[model samples]
Target: MKFRRKHYTDDTLLALYKAILKPRLIEEKMLILLRQNRISKWFSGIGQEAIAVGSTMALQEDEYILPLHRNLGVFTVRNCPLHQLFAQFQGKPTGFTKGRDRSFHFGTQEHHIIGMISHLNAQLPVADGIALADMLANRNKVTLAYSGDGGTSEGDFHEALNVAAVWNLPVIFLIENNGYGLSTPNNEQYKCEYLVSRGAGYGMKAVQIDGNNVLEVYDTIVQLSAQMRENPHPVLVEALTFRMRGHEEASGTKYVPQVLLDKWSALDPVSNYEKFLLQEGILTEAVIAEIRALIKEEINVGLEKAFLDKMPEADTKQELQDMYKPFVQTAHAPANATKTEKRYIDAISDALRESMLAYPNLVLMGQDIAEYGGVFKITDGFVKQFGKERVRNTPLCESAIIGAALGLSINGYKAMVEMQFADFVSCGFNQIVNNLAKSYYRWGQHADVVIRMPTGAGTAAGPFHSQSNEAWFFHTPGLKIVYPSNPYDAKGLLNAAIEDPNPVMYFEHKSLYRSVAAAIPDSYYTVPIGKAVLTAIGEDLTIITYGMGVHWCLEILAKHPEIHADLIDLRTLLPWDKETVAASVKKTGKVLVVHEDCLTGGIGGEIAAWVAEHCFTSLDAPVMREGSLDTAVPFAPTLEQNFLPKYRIEEKIKKLLAF
Candidate 1:
């Protein structure tokens, strides 16, 4: 094969040779380990090493690279230790994820590599966020995000690319078109001639290149990197390559046609590059052999040590405790108090203002968050105060907003994302549950992002607009759920959430935005996340609730003064103050949980269960719950009131007293 020379030095040619050879040898050894049952599974980059190495070669040591499962050559180029990579493959305690995850599901903050999620194209928005952060900090670093031809079909792919282009972010979208997404061919994925062409629709520069040729891949990426450094605009590059092996070691290539397989096998990237090196006189036969032998020897030694490494012992208690560590803050509250009376909405806005001023890297992103000041005016003056760079108004993309926020958070920026309404959080559920919540546990990394959700039903906003969706996140581990009942807690918690080193779903009741007001302290203070506040103390029974339900419980107590009960506001749902609830349960000897969300699968059930399990002997009556009927929230005010009326809660309280 005749190769085009693009003015590459001998050292650069040899470096590329070593880069391709290392991953090829390591992947070949991984296949042997899979056969020997030493490693669980293997996803090979056997024929696509050039794309991985070439795309990453131009990246500086401090720049970020988000690589997929098959991009083993990326780790090699990043100088990730072979023994650690082998340990991760073998599921040892010393692995990147502490052996909790396998095969490209791990990354280290120290390496500046964003670990990949199994869901394809999900990391693109995250990469955009990292680039956005770099841009905000005036850092001249570019983020390289890798995906496959099949990933282009996912909604996240388009959302990520669009945002990157619109913001002119320094992110390179490298799509390794391996002709197949698992078993499905490229034709089934899209009818477009090339994936790179789609970038035009997003207003981004696009290019297509033969990924098999190492020199071409390197030159193209180097040029793209240089362009991105100067202009900071996203560039989509479709590197045409092929998945020469099955998706995983256990997945047979029986579905693939042998002719197609043989065609790609003949154009093997490693072999073709070696031939090019030899023909160009950049490497002699002896040198090529020596490089191959050295890589194989290194792989063997790493494999032997990794195989002997111990597996991590299971510790459910420690794991759970680690997942919910207390939020640590770097900034202190102002010593002098500037007390002021403000509505819930104003309090929230003030918190955002204070936090942004306190932390220069703090960012606010959402639909209508900047110029429009959000739908509820919660961020009314953020744009003018913080400017468009920090207070960004994103497209109507809930998933990307959250995904990008996660990326920014991981890259050392504090991002507060606003989901227009709580009901819409379902759109970004995967990013929240799968990526945001699990990032810390999977890779021991913090997605220090706060998602502010305008929640609850009060103005008859119907099902989609008004929903108490805190329960959706309550069940998800590695997330902190805070539902503030008043302006004081709202401001304090929002500040705390923004400063916290984890993903927090901060729910603010839409009804209470203006209706709830108080003379909140104007000094920075974090309402303890997991602690519940005792509103009214009594002895007959205990009413535990949060959000709008807290106000309803207060209304119920005022109406029926004869029914004396301790009212406990559970501000944080996930790590609910068990001690406070149990102590109140012991004193009152009765428990009743209330909320506005549907009765079925509500956080109330979990609260009831916990009280029953922990304070069984103290309970003088059955643990009861009051919630809306198991149906969609109605649009009509009468129906909405009937659905979750104050009378219904009173009825439950009466029944608990009778018991």
Candidate 2:
């Protein structure tokens, strides 16, 4: 039968209402707990319950719902125990998140809720990804995503909608227009009067509905969702509602005007629904009282359980110590693991080829990565071998490319996305910080992804192309950041990143792409993440570097043999190899950190801090750091060289010898 669009009838409304009200009562109790100082904080979906409940009701029991923080109502309807949610808010072990997720970012895989993400606009692309996975699995499930009106202003929002529309994915975007985002009113925040109108720009079927009216919301979603599941196309629904409270627990009624509250309070979803039910003879005043009593009981039981739950103990932490344990243990092996063989670009190509063969779910994507071999020719001829699906080429939209890559990752594909140039990554910053970095903590291992970007400054590509922006991502948590200085680490770490589960930002040095060469094994192998290599040993001082800086130091080392030095290459930054670095600094008793990124808040500062703490007692002198000056990387070779560290290993060794 062809899918028809319309609202749910009485029977469907009754089922959906029962599911939604249960969660609403829990939210109210959670708020009460916050007031009592029992829980830290919470963002309530008190006024806009229908949008979450009604929309989720349209989905199959097992279909994924990648909700924003405010959509706890959806998770409750999906059968996530109220106690587990309360415990999550309380940061207890029994919580759905296991006490890892930040408040508001909570849910569970067991409940078939993909999890709630705290990043404002991220759920849209993730929803697209869930739909893609369902489509690939040949499942009839659809993904429903709920976001606030404020989130619609984000670039990821447009990127997700565009990709979903083009691919005809099965996704339902529900925008809960909840009047205010923090303190900014909807009118002041966006030019558009209706958030749903933005969907039309992406060529999607969109509607604006009365979100406070559960009957209307249920009716609309029921009619639209069937078409989405049957044919697999994306649609949007703008739910117009009002906020009954401030943004979160920290926010009070001070910023909210009394008039708006009076107006909206009169239109509370539960009250309006009760009136509708009474008028339709579906419910009576006595039955409503009984329903409220039952809801209160449910909330009390859930709260009691949450209060008794314990936080994770030492054993649980010890058990998960190395959960994604390394397969190859070459720790005791000599530097014989290091080899001088293939060109750097060739190693990247080989890594991709080998990884593709090793993992069926690994995919390569970027502009011209297929037949064109990529602009730099790094991915030259990969499409002919891997096919267009795996080694795909995309349009010039960097945001769209990243947005789609995010979706692919959610669908259980490790997407190695290449930005034609390092500077172009700035265009997809939202995906990097808001989605990829925060996804793991938000979703509780629901999304693991990888992004491979070509970077660094030696090419005279000017200020626009040569900028080293690693600092932007280094500040973010839950993301693994890596920069390989040689072909061996490049291939090994790339393999590890693809094989492991987590979102990774892998930066390939543009200057070292073809200039460097090293030996690599044909057999599949991996270098451990968060491990640094002591490339050269000496007596004077240690030079901490990675990527192009590592190569530069090697050349400087050979020139000044008189002044002994040790070189340590930090392969990864987020979970840096502090142990290795501390040991190296202790041996040398002095340190100099180098990188292509700007001086302030760069990797150098990080290393210097580590030395000050762990290697302080061993140091003979104050640790120093060398990096590009605080300015745009100039196009002229002379200025660019000046911008970079002129104090190479030899110069540093000479200084250390004097010290």
Candidate 3:
């Protein structure tokens, strides 16, 4: 417990003691409440207070922190009022998330803390993103991220470390290795001698520290944080400790060996720290008693306020409204602006280039997107114009890049991620669905990011490269999906997606990238996200489609000009133009939904169900849906063509028209 040098004075030491002491008391109180059935759950960091307290206090106050569930000391150290913290645990309306989430799951922007998701190591890459903001702005700021020993085994752990290492982000990745991950012993968790040793593989500096030694933990982090600030690099600091309790209060610690518990019990961090404070002449018996008495009073007052606070009443309307923030276009094209015909891909490039210039906070990250451009050359010249910081070429790690985008968004930067292909997004699915999509709803942290997905099949690129996977994200809440068929809509929609304050999935059809062309405006303009375009207006039937389907239906209509139909291109999938569809369905009295995805569980099914429910009285025939057959997209041209709905779109339109 001896320190080589002391960074803090007597006053600072006393403050540190209070910071460590309060959370210890709080954990004890929470356990009592849990046993009394007053609280639903508790993850007690009983013997591990040193790791949370020392590391947090060592960092600069303005620097960001991502704390795990067990790190209750972080909130106390940050000066969060105990009453509000209790109210959060109590799920009260006055809580941080306003009762939307429970316990330490919610993040408070005021504190510069991003709370951890249950998928523990996922926040590692996010820390890199926050550091990226600091690095880009040349700020001497560092990020502190925590994960359990078990979390080190996840793919996100490796992805995050490698990303930080290669980028040289200023982040202190602290692993609170408490010997077990929900009763899974470290003996079975990793084969390596120590988690810190694994940092060598990523070319990161790493060290192991005694979790029970507050002075050692605090000094090590203080020095490490200073080093990282001076020379911007990630470090892995593993604090070896033992959890004295179960994963949760309900899960009894019967699995733990009695001998191990005895060994750790004598080395309890809170008590051990108190002894050190006494030895250092920082606290007398009377002062310690007085501090304890004051904490009890504080805890009592916090409990009173929490118990008096009213529970949040569920409001469906408000809940749905909170999912997405209103996006307003700051820039627009001239009303009578001159236009020229361009390919869909060129239009996307133009819109992106325009957005980068219009919004200095905007940044783009993807694999092979910088000097080499993208695989499709969408961002071919981005780095030359916007510089490497904004136009970043990330490693081939989808999850890390996506999570980093969320991190950048958290720090007031608008980030966009370009998935090499649509199907490849599955690698980053957890980050999109769980982290980015849930951030705003969980804690009002807006993910001002746009994920550019190159989607659809037609070029015989096979299953991995080509996919119409909007349906995967369509089912997830809190995500905006946009698909455009022509160059005009592509530019407008892409701009709108960038303008949005939430996460947007902008789907660009691979086949239509070079084929589809239209007179795109020279200036920037945003198409409203929830609005659909009527490509060809008619009264025969309501033909709903998007991406490549819009062109298919146009050709079908030209072949038989007599069979006129309302060809509606739903540019945005989520928060779709339902009013426009309902109006068209009522006008035509029949509905046909077309998509390039497989027939079963396709977006067409959802549209058809809605049409059947709302436009049943107006329909002249049952809602017909045409999609690719339920099978993998083949590599052969004919097989791939047959696998998509491109050939069947004309037949579907004609059948609905005749019906």
Number of the candidate with higher TM-score, 2 or 3:
3
Task: List, residue by residue over 344-459, the lDDT tens digit for candidate 2.
Answer: 78778877888898777776778788899998898887777877767877666577666656666666676778888878988878777766665554444433567787888877
| Each model's lDDT | 0.87, 0.75, 0.89
TM-score against native, each model = 0.98, 0.86, 0.98
User: What is candidate 3's TM-score against the reference?
Assistant: 0.98
lDDT of 2 at 77: 76
- Between candidates 1 and 2, the one scoring higher on lDDT is 1
Give me the displacement of residue 558 in model 2, in angstroms. 2.8
What tens-digit string does per-residue lDDT give for candidate 3 at 486-512?
A: 888899999989988989999999999
Worst 10 residues of 2 by lDDT: 324-333
Whole-model lDDT, model 2: 0.75
lDDT, candidate 1, equals 0.87
Residue 66 of candidate 2: its Cα lDDT? 72
Q: What C-alpha RMSD separates each model from the true structure? A: 1.5, 4.4, 1.3
lDDT of 1 at 536: 94
lDDT of 1 by residue, 585-606 (tens): 9999999999889999999998
